[model samples]
Target: MNFYTVLEYIGMFLVFVGALFLFLGALGIFRLPDVYNRLQAGTKATTLGAFGAIIGIGLMRPEWLPKAILIAVFILMTNPISSHALARASYRRGIKLWDRSVVDRYGPYLREKEEKEGKR
Candidate 1:
C-alpha cells in the first residue's frame, strides 16, 4: 500500500484505541464511589484517549499536525492539574471518600489545617 494509506490505517487504529480508553473512563466514572476517583479516571483516561486520536489525526493529515499537536500538549498539561484541584476542593468541602479507599495521604494535611484554624 501507499504511505498515505498506511498512515490512514495507523490513524484508524489509534482512533479505535482512543475510543476504548474513553469507554473505560466512562465506566470508571460510573463505578467509582467518590468524586476523586471518578475525576482520576475521567482526566487521565480521557486525556490519553483524546491525545491518541489527535496524534492519529495529525499523522493522517500532515497539514493539521501542528494544531493537533498543540491541542494534545495543552490537554496533557492541563488535565492533571484540573483534576487535582477538583479533588482537593471536594476533599476540603468534606466530600466523603470511597469505602474502598485504603489510605488517605491528604488526611494529615487536612487535619493539620483544621487544627491550625481551631476547627479540629
Candidate 2:
C-alpha cells in the first residue's frame, strides 16, 4: 500500500476506537447512578474519544494537524475543570449522591465556606 493509504487506514482505525469510547461514555451516562459519575463519563471518556478522533483526522490530513492538536489541547485543559465546577455546584445545591458513593471530599470545603460566611 501507498504511504497515504496506510495513514488513511490508521486514521480510520483510530476513528473507530474513538467512536467506541464515545459510545461507552454515553452508555455510562445513562447507566450511572449519580451526577458525579455521569460527569465523569461525560468529561473523561468523551474528551479522550474526541481527542482520538481529532488525532486520527490529523494523521490523515497533515496540514490540519496543528489545528487538530490545538482543539485536543483546549479540550484537555477545560473539560475536567468544567466537570469539577459542575460537581461542586451540584454538591453546594444539595444534589443527592449515589447510595454507593464512598466519600465526600467537597463536603468539608463547603462546610468551611459556610463557617467563614457565618463568621463574616
Model 1: lowest-lDDT 10 consecutive positions: 111-120
Q: How high is the lDDT of residue 63 in model 2? A: 88
RMSD of each: 2.2, 1.5
**Structural similarity to truth (TM-score) of each candidate:** 0.89, 0.89
Candidate 1 displacement at residue 47 in angstroms: 0.8
Error of 1 at 67 (Å): 0.8
Q: How many backbone overlaps does candidate 1 show?
A: 0
RMSD in Å for model 2: 1.5
lDDT of each residue in 1-120, candidate 1, tens digit only = 999999889988998898899899999999987798799899989999999989899988988989999999999999999888898889888898988888888889878887999963
lDDT of each: 0.89, 0.89
lDDT of 1: 0.89
Count steric clashes of candidate 2. 0
Which lDDT tens digits does candidate 2 get at residues 2-107? 9999998998888889888989889989998899889989888899899899889998998898999999899889989999999989987999789888887777
**Which regions of candidate 2 fall more than 4 Å away from where they truly are?**
none
